[model samples]
Target: MARNAGKRTSTKLVFLLSCAGLLGAALIADFLWASSSSHSHAYASIASNWVLEKSGTVVVPNKEKAEAVKSKNNSVDARILSGTFADLPGPELKWEKMAPAPVPRLDGSAVQIKNLLYVFAGYGTIDYVHSHVDIYNFSDNKWVGKLDMPKEMAHSHLGMVTDGRYVYVVSGQYGPQCRGPTSRTFVLDTETKQWQRMPPLPVPRYAPATQLWKGRLHVMGGSKEDRHEPALDHWSIAVEDGKALEKEWRTEIPIPRGGPHRACIVADDRLMVIGGQEGDFMPKPGSPIFKCSRRHEVVYSDVYMLDDEMKWKTLPPMPKPNSHIEFAWILVNNSILISGGTTEKNPITKKMILVGEVLRFDLNTMKWSVYGRMPYRIKTTLAGFWDGWLYFTSGQRDRGPENPQPRKVVGEMWRTKIHL
Candidate 1:
């Protein structure tokens, strides 16, 4: 009886020890799994793994697929063909509606100073040229009426830049009718709400590309008086005390192919010229002012960069021939984000077909990629970036194929949080 009791005690002790060991192993496995899951979520959030599929759609892979790609050779093509590219979840670009403007406007010049956005002259209802200056308070997110521009300064297609305290308004058209270009320039002190006329541009032009770089105003290609002849001329002038100096403008290397409504941005101390149209507004044949035999217009996809030495170098052309002149662009994360331009015009209808696609160009790789498409077609809008967000003001929308003048003006305002 004593031997049987001792045997039973030993058996019970063995069972307890085995149970403890299994529990300890299970706890370690759970801890490791939790840590790995947290790390994966963090990595997926920061990585640029979202790709545009060949079907003109954007796809974001799930965590399982993302991890699988990371574990393999990391070839995007291979992962895409692995039969897991359908409906995978990922980060997406989000757009939010903002306060609308008081009136619908287009082709205006916009500049930001601190928490204020100053919108200059633009075309309003019935194509009426507006001289009123509409100010938007970033804090309040509302439009506040301000002083009107001088009667002479009331024009659209103007170029504008700001130095945080003052805004410099450059050349644009004058009066309601699309008549001729104006060399007039003006400066406004935001604090005083006062306006002062500055030295005029050397040549009369409208829709010129202007930038304030290193205390100087760099003016690039624009259209001449006829609107048909695009100028290849580039000039720079010294700006002092919120006024352009009396010194003559210095001429730089001319653009290879001058374009009207071109976009110029200062990136990494280099001036980049985006898409523009070569021949626009050329008078049709049998008109009183027909100067050239060729009246057809050509939109260019070519890009050029200007360095500090005043040398011009050509860069790779964009994938698509985008030429919606006077479009808006913003620089984010060392990449240029261009939105709402025209890819081409209808050959027979002569109507401008808006390019609904959004594109991004990486400065590091010198490559262009399609980011996504806008919810609706937008063109000739004023865009600016503030507080890591992009604001797009009033612009024109496509009125479909039935309308004669298919471009319909709108007063919608939109904003989006920029992630890349």
Candidate 2:
């Protein structure tokens, strides 16, 4: 009986030790697995490895889509693009109207900092151009005044982009109203509300499309001195140590074809420029009116795409030959939302054709389609994307007889939502 008890005790001890060893190994394996999983997940989140991950999608809300998702309350939201259109009545996209700017100004540049939009330098009322800066709060829905610009620039185009703080104003035309093609660059610090002069462009170009990409700002395809003469000159400015220096100015790829002096967005490292008047807007005799034939008008629907190698590839053209002063916003993956501008003749006409057509371009698919028009017609307007919608303010209709000096501005505000 003693021998049997000893054997049983030894057998129990062996089993317990075996079980403990197994448990220890399992715990260690689990610990290693957890550590490896954490590392893999973190890397996957930041690396943008589409192959190792599923493709994400965006659905813009429209009449059809909005109704489809109405039951599922959290899935869709309806919004509107307001203001005016040549043919459309009322607001196009059911948008919330905001407070107008203190004074209406056209061709003014806007940059968003800290979720706030800042407007600066353009043609103001009284037929006199001033360097005024207006700050608008989206959350509060009001326009507040800031300090004046350091120099007065009249009849100028502001090529603007922001690093989320400092707004970089690139090569634009500015001078006296009559002789306003001076090559100038300015930088504004949104935090301090300060403006400083930066290095000027090699040549004077107005309404040039400027964009920031690959740590450099590219200024390309603008008018040299006259509106009729377009510059194929492409220049890149490097921002270093918080100043625009001349040594940093290097020429890159010239535009394949001369485009109007309007900047479009650089989406997916691809740069595009939209419409501007191809022929010169020469002053007519006996009248202050400018006349030009549309025969020489090289209306561009061809959207050019610039690659990292600085080579140009023509994407599908814009849906229409509409190019007053259009702006582009990144709607979603491989798609851009473009809106506003004029669809009139190059020199314009007694009856201005204000374009409210909002179109979307799919970069991946190379297709173009119309969305909706603004409630009102706007030309020479400054537009940028903020939050989740398209925000455009401070524009002017076609040159009216009341304001023949070309400084009439608009006070209305509009927004467009892309349901995706």
Candidate 3:
């Protein structure tokens, strides 16, 4: 674990205060920055000190440091579970483990289009990022197809979203761990299974908050490579049918916070940004290769929304901070429900704590609540909503600073029933 784990621990994890109560509402009469969370910038299941290289062992960490982690106390999670989960107005929820991925993964993203679930680029082991795509058939409950992303596509720290049959993948770290980012953008058409290159992002970033807003694709807040610089730049472009209508991206309102690994969503016609951290690692200066940041990372619970006037307003903070949950959210029954990501680090242990609550933000109450409890804690989880089931899969498991899950990186999919 890195330093500053207690108060300023890095959000090397994902966001809705770590994402999604994902309800977009405001009791905040004040214009405020939105909350967000994110995945640790495409890291494998290891501590922050180990460096991932392009040709070296990216998935495996240094053995000496890896061994040191085992000596830590394995106390069960000290965080309390909500007694109010049962009180939430929904049907009973039960979780079941589905078939695991053919390969393990972390810091990945997924999209559900029609009956197929598309699992896209991520690190297979730390050595390199996978450009491959895996498609799971909901009807068959199995992985039915596999393909590859464009060579120009980003490997990790990606900003992605779906509009109809097209998936827009935006700027992100292009190479292996902690490397420089790419300004390129690509769109994948699920129906045709083809990719089209769009005008590149004007500014490159890591895990930026990308969303499809009214008539344009909006991208905001990521980090500057080589330091923990939180980028506030917002850019957009006009697009139609998976093709860029504009030759270049246009500038928009800069986000108030460092928007890496956060969730940006539109609900009830309001645009919101939620739960992400500033500062990942400060890489050693002037190294052509990669190592680690000299500083620690910090996760937060701030939240903001864009009002009808096209300006931002502050919403209430989540009860606790969450990270590594960039896509772990779904809209159901007018509420934003998010699940499974990292929270704060244990004060004494200084190790990261994975979240176990199934959190909800109600548009009706304009409030956040624990709607359910997780089967276990996980991070970098991809989520989806289909029929009446809440589904999540693919993330790194905490190896028990408290209760651990599968002990390492995983590919298992889990779902719980929660009818509207």
lDDT of each: 0.68, 0.59, 0.71
Candidate 1 error regions (>4 Å): 1-93, 282-295, 324-327, 400-405
Give the candidates in order of lDDT, highest first.
Answer: 3, 1, 2
Off by over 4 Å in 3: 1-93, 285-289, 404-407
Candidate with top TM-score is 3
For candidate 3, lDDT tens digit of each residue in 26-104?
4232224322111333242235323222121122223334335544543222233211221123333589888878767
Model 2: weakest 10-residue lDDT segment is: 49-58
Q: Quote the positional error of residue 347 for candidate 1 in Å.
A: 4.4
Models sorted by TM-score, best on top: 3, 1, 2
| TM-score for candidate 3 | 0.77
Q: What value does the lDDT take at residue 323 in candidate 3?
A: 69
Report the C-alpha displacement of residue 119, candidate 2, in angstroms: 1.4
